[model samples]
Target: MKELINKYYQNHSLIYKVLLFLITTAVIVYFFPKGGKFKYNLQKGKPWQYENLYAPFDFSIQKSPEELNAEKEEIEKSKQLFFLVKEEVKAEVIESYNKKVDFILKDSLALKMNKARLKNFGEKFINNVYKVGFLNKADNSKIQSNQLITLRLGNEASDILSDNLFTTDELVSSIQQYFTNSSYESLENNFTSLFFEILEPNVFYDEELTNRALEEELKNRSFTKGFVAENERIISKGDMVDASKYEILDSLKKEYDTQLWSKSSYNWIVVGYTILVALVLVMLFLFLKKYRLEIFHNNTKLTFILFNIVLFVFLVTIVQKYFVGYLYVVPIIILPIVLKAFFDARLGLFTHVLTVLLLGFIVPNSFEFVFLQIIAGMVTILTVSELHRRANLFVSILKITLIYTVAYLAFSIIQNGSEQKIQWVYFGMFALNGVLSFLSLFLILIYEKSFGLVSDVSLLELSDTNSTLLRELNEKAPGTFQHSMQVANLAEASANEIGANAMLVRAGALYHDIGKMLNPMYFTENQTTSVSPHHDLSPTDSAKIIRDHVIKGIEMAKKNGLPDRLIDFIRTHHGTNTIYYFYKMQSELTPDQVNIEDFKYPGPIPFSKETAILMMCDSCEAASKSLKTPTALLIDELVEKVINTQMSQGQFMNSDITFKEIQTIKKVIKKKLHNIYHLRIEYPE
Candidate 1:
């Protein structure tokens, strides 16, 4: 039992990878929307390719959107709008008119005789205006004269022509017209002024009541106009889906998707979703395991990849639930852009395609959505080669947006066949998706800090020679700084030749010997004087100082907050090779007292191509500087000897560098060194 536990602990990494995939699969399944899918792909104007379709049960035929919209428009155009009558305003006007009418009339012997007639006329005119209903003149333009509006007075409501209502201006005109035909033309001004002063609008448009009435009317509108009985054949195979056939099939599909099934059936649906989602995740696992074993071995990176997939899936699910019209606005292309930034284009595109395939089950128009996202993802991987340049990302976004718009447009044209039926709103959605894709830059920064991973953009920033750490190295150890620069150039060139990470290797090379800054004169390159500090110290002490620089470098790098990837160079540049010169001196002086481990570097060795290249370049570049006079043949011999010695000592045993790549690197280093020394080819004399 103890041995079994130990065995489990021993293979924990492999076990963790298995659990990682399983957990991710389960999480994705949880995010999968619950529902049954209609087993047919519906496309208007396409032939029914399946067997004769029959209604499983009696279901209503849902009206098409166009049909429902037409009904709504007709109702909106003819609906009776409500206007609430202000009975209080009418009473106030009547009461104030009686009080103010005397002000308009003066006592005259002839006027007194007609005073009763004038008072009666004034009361009748006021009553007539209010009875006809006074409305604001500004509202007249919104409703047509013949349009019907319901006038609600107290508890009673009556529909009337909008033209029947009197405006304040019309009331004045009517008073003047009445005076012109009668004998009291001189009293026109007085009557007009008095009535106008006392009159107030007593009717207003009741938008709330109008909306309630409209809703009541709409309640009578039926969503379905017809019903198909059970066992009725909806369409025959190979029949072109005409308008009538399309509606029945669409209605059946809606009913089928929304219909509740038994628990056993729902569980089977869950099982189906699980199997499909698991299959996709397994394919992704196999891809990583076969083609990207390094990333596959790293649980953090694999989890990052899986997290992105699930994150986008959740985003798509939410959008589909609430904002289905803007489903394309989710920035599906961000997956490939982010993956390509941290990894490579092939892996980015592969993972993106699989993710999009998973989303097919959730988004509408599955084929079109998958095609558009897959194409856009491919364009993202192809166009955005360098995340270090912000301009490149912008340009890639534009290209991706263009691809999305063009692909979606083509699909629309193919399905609808006419440009008139195309939904142009999707173009705006594609543009929004592109804009959101820029969020990947911000997300990349977050991922770097959160996951402790590195990207090309970060590597590029570190490669700047004027950065804080590199600047400090230059000030304290100028020779070592210059040496690091040469090694950076050599490592970068070799990495480019072997398809390795050029930026990463260059950044690592610049900071590899930063610990030499502490004791600048102890290193031969940093020493300016002819006398050596080592001459005054014992060989054991000197060798100890040399071996301690690696440890010191790691400490300084961490204090400066450099990425762990670059710190690997500091740890493995010398690998575990012995400080042979000082060791030999110590052995000769006190052969009985020497311990071999004290003179060796504490190393984990190079574990990748970039680190292996740095190991080779650092040793070859530093060794080449020691030659009194460098020739083409001498440089070649030094390069071969340095790299061959590292190879024999098993420094590169953990790294994946090939023997051919090493030979190529040796040639590149020899050429770079020769150029540094300005060596010329010798002619046969």
Candidate 2:
């Protein structure tokens, strides 16, 4: 049944197409009624007929002519009043004009009749006219009684016209028109009483009264009343439309159609939404498929899934918030880290490319960010690819930062094509982000530490030359220290030959026999000039005591927070191998009563290449020290014997050590052992 499901899922393209067809059919079914209605309405001149069909109520309102007539009468009254004021102002203006003319003529006549020095007479005449306020100010005194009487008789007209007072025809016309028009209106309507009552002398001085009258006139004007009446018509609801209630009903109907999946627009929206949702699922499935292979091959658990999710979310959020343009490209940094933590650099490179493509869908931008990101990510991966120590992380980050700077500058120049220097601000920001990438590695480390997930880098750090525990071992147990150093060289060489992490193997070597520090003298290698502590004890007691060191080392290691990778090497180094020499010695002394298992070093056997190498190196070193007539050939023979014995006993079975790798390890061990066991020359003294 599982196989059938798997096969069916494997042919997903056909299934997806069928699903699409079914969804299209459903959408057509749902929208058929509404689509037909829309098409019918569109054929008519009322495409918005649906809105009209749903309208619920009506109201009638209109304007009457009487109201318009009343407004017009008010407008006429204001106009009449305005004209009356205008005519009165005109008469007053004419009167002021005549007075000015009379004053000017009288002044000139005085100058001519007196025959006083005529020098500057015109200037004096103008001055005297202005001083009397004759211009627009009526001066009744300037109109002489004799001039009035002469004008009434129509006599002396020629003489008067020739005189300087009446030298111009304009002066004669001014005087005659003012007196005739002004007296005609004044006498017709008791103008003095009307002026005092309706147009007070202080009316011109009363700004407030003038403003109020102007405002009243404006209110009664035809245009203002017409505008107000039009506004009333607009405000009054008309029978043509209860548009507000109609709009509400139309909106509710639209919402109902949408809810029932009855609209064609809804179908399109659903299709688009479906496509987006399907794409998201497809992306998730692709991610799972890709990583499933890795997880299966590695025998990893959900922690890897959790870790990747964390990495994905963290990287996506960072890209979204800080570097929107580079969102797609910037997340490639996490690819190298994920690869290094979970797999290798080659896999990291592959995943980096995959991440770029995935992010391209998420973040749309110019291709330059993508190119720069790929370059930066590749540089980061390559730099950290062979890291063997914690310090290498810094070097990798620094190198990546430099590469990113150079790449950014080069790409910036290529893209911008200007003489302006690349901004250090951008470089600084990129460097800061790179540093953040470096810090993110520490987060991976902390996760690895908390979860007991051993990686090559973490193992290397634990066994580094600067490890405090290893240094302490060297100081406290020099003999064990020397032994550890020899084992480290052998293990590192063997590991390098077998395509394993040499630094991890070397570091593991330096602390593999740390258990011996607890009971150094019980072991042959640490026995200086002192008496042997195990001599008085039975072989079983001595073996038990020796076995206790492995247990003690684990406790000590735990107390110091040593990583489990190093601890594994210490635990499995002996790997159920026997104390054959002691067992043999005891078997000869008590042949029938001896139990072979009693003389064995308690172990579960080597579980990894590093531990297997440590086991071989430890045995070879101990056996090499026992050789009395040491030679390169003897050392090689003994090394091969120890390796074969371990192999025959199945000590290497659980480890990843292959037969070909074992042969390479043997050759390396033979060379190193030969150097250590080479005989010293006896010179002639």
Candidate 3:
């Protein structure tokens, strides 16, 4: 099995790559939530887009969240709280105060007051205790009516009292009034103070009993306010949907969504989702294959693009299910920004549109979601297409976020015809999304490094001559370093003319000859003295030394953390072409048995327009330096001869550069080299 897998991978064709991509897409699409599709797209105050809807079954009209909450509040407010009244409370109180009353009567005997008056005072206090009925301290304040109270005397007996019911406050008032109207008013003051201190309520609020009563009352309240009979038109066509009408339609939508699974086979839902996802993904594949074949052929690039799409869909599904109305908080625009950084604007927009469409199944308003996401994606592409600088990204993100806010506001006004109904939290979310989108810049750097991809920011950093590698190259081999700069200029100009990646070609040219730094004195470009080191060396030895630079440079670059995209230029610059000077010298010196294999540099050849342009520029710029006379004709001839020689050697055979682009590059090189070496007339001294 491993052998078969290895054999298949050895031939890595386009069909296999596409099959892998399709399998990945299928796996990713299968993980998406296929709960159910929305049956209707109705909105409040908007005309019904579908046909006149009627109740298919006699399902009860479910109440809105607001209606259900209001009903709960009403039930809570009107429900009576139950309290357990103890009828023996009065007897217990009288028993507790009997000794105190006897002490007060003994004191009256000492004062020589009337025994009848003292007895009257004790009776009045006892009557007040029974009148108030030992009100509960905790719940007596909440009793607002003089209703009947059920007194639990003991386990065996119970009594019902009709007129003794009083709240704690009323009980205290009754005690004070009884003392004030006592027959012995002056002595009753001391009695009232002492009785009030000992007063304790036997009746207590019953939490369990209250909760049981509340549960019973709530059970009677209906969650469904009314029922819609079969064949009843919920809302006719062209009707302006008011709040009440919107509630009925929404209830119908909820019911319809619930009933969708029972009416339709679940397998059909899976098939429908599969077809929709496939169609959108297939369109994306075709677009990339036709216009951006480079990315299409690369598995890493394709994986990054498709992974972003699937991840966004998964996140939207979760947010829609849990976060509900906060879907706008998701940074949908960041996907385009990140893709645009690695790929191009067209692919970014395409991926974003496909993702939003797949997520439309879960978002509440399909039209609103698609509209906002598509507009944000387009704005991201337009404002940040050329994202080479940090400030450009900041400005672009702000604009895209503002566009989301304004567009959402406009949609809100169009739907409800008023700004009062718009949720301001969504606007805050859009602004926050804009701020968070700045993280894409960092993510782009990460993707470039991880995937062996090159981005504009990395290219710009590579182009700087002051970078550690470039500065080291300049100090180690000044001549080779100058040659690299001239090649960079020529390659950049030619790339611009041919509509290729000018920045990429320029960065490649700057680092193409970094391998020479390992043994700078062996190459002619860095030879500062008149003495020639090759005079003592054999031609075969010289060729080997020259060819080893490519291998050594790759090791140094890998050690120093240079990306593979830049290392490709070092590998392909010399290609499989032979070192002609040493080979010819060796043939002339030993013509009897000349070996051609020792003179060639091992290479994969230039496979891209940027690398091929670097090869041509490297050869032309080095050859132009050998001209003895400084004239336009000599420079022009030098450029043409070098380009024609490289072309005939088939150095660009595998590259995508056309013959017409080659000619255009030749013209650009001639003009640039001429302008550099043009003669200046001698001035009179």
Backbone collisions counted per model = 0, 1, 0
Write one digit per residue (lDDT tens) for candidate 1, span 416-446. 6677878888888888888999999999999
Least accurate stretch of 10 residues (summed lDDT) in model 1? 104-113
User: Mind sharing the TM-score for model 3?
Assistant: 0.73
Q: How close is candidate 2 to the true structure, as a TM-score?
A: 0.49
- lDDT of candidate 2 over 1-685, digit per residue (tens): 9999998988765565445434533432332232211111111111233322422222122223344567656654433111011124434633444444334334533345432232233234333322222211122223332231111111221112112232222333433443354313223222222222222110012234334666677575442111112112221122232333323333333334454465357566555544543454345345544644323223232335334543554566567667764443343475576566545555566556544544443332324455666787788766675544558777777777777778767755643355384555767667676667765566567767566566666766776666788887776777888888888888888888887767767777787777778777788777787689878988778878887788888888888887666787878888888887778878888999999998886787986677888888888887888888888878888988999999999998877678998899889899888777666799999
Task: Kindly state the number of residue pairs that clash in model 1.
Answer: 0
Best of the candidates, TM-score: 1
Residue 495's lDDT in candidate 3: 92
Rank by TM-score (best first):
1, 3, 2
For model 1 the local lDDT of residue 605 reads 85
RMSD of 1: 5.9
Q: Which prediction has more favorable TM-score, 2 or 3?
A: 3
Candidate 3: tens digits of C-alpha lDDT, residues 10-98: 76766666676677567655766655666677666677667787888777878877678889899877666555656676676667676
Q: Give the residue spans of candidate 1 off by over 4 A.
A: 1-8, 43-55, 58-74, 86-122, 136-142, 177-187, 225-249, 260-264, 421-425, 464-484, 497-499, 511-564, 567-674, 677-685
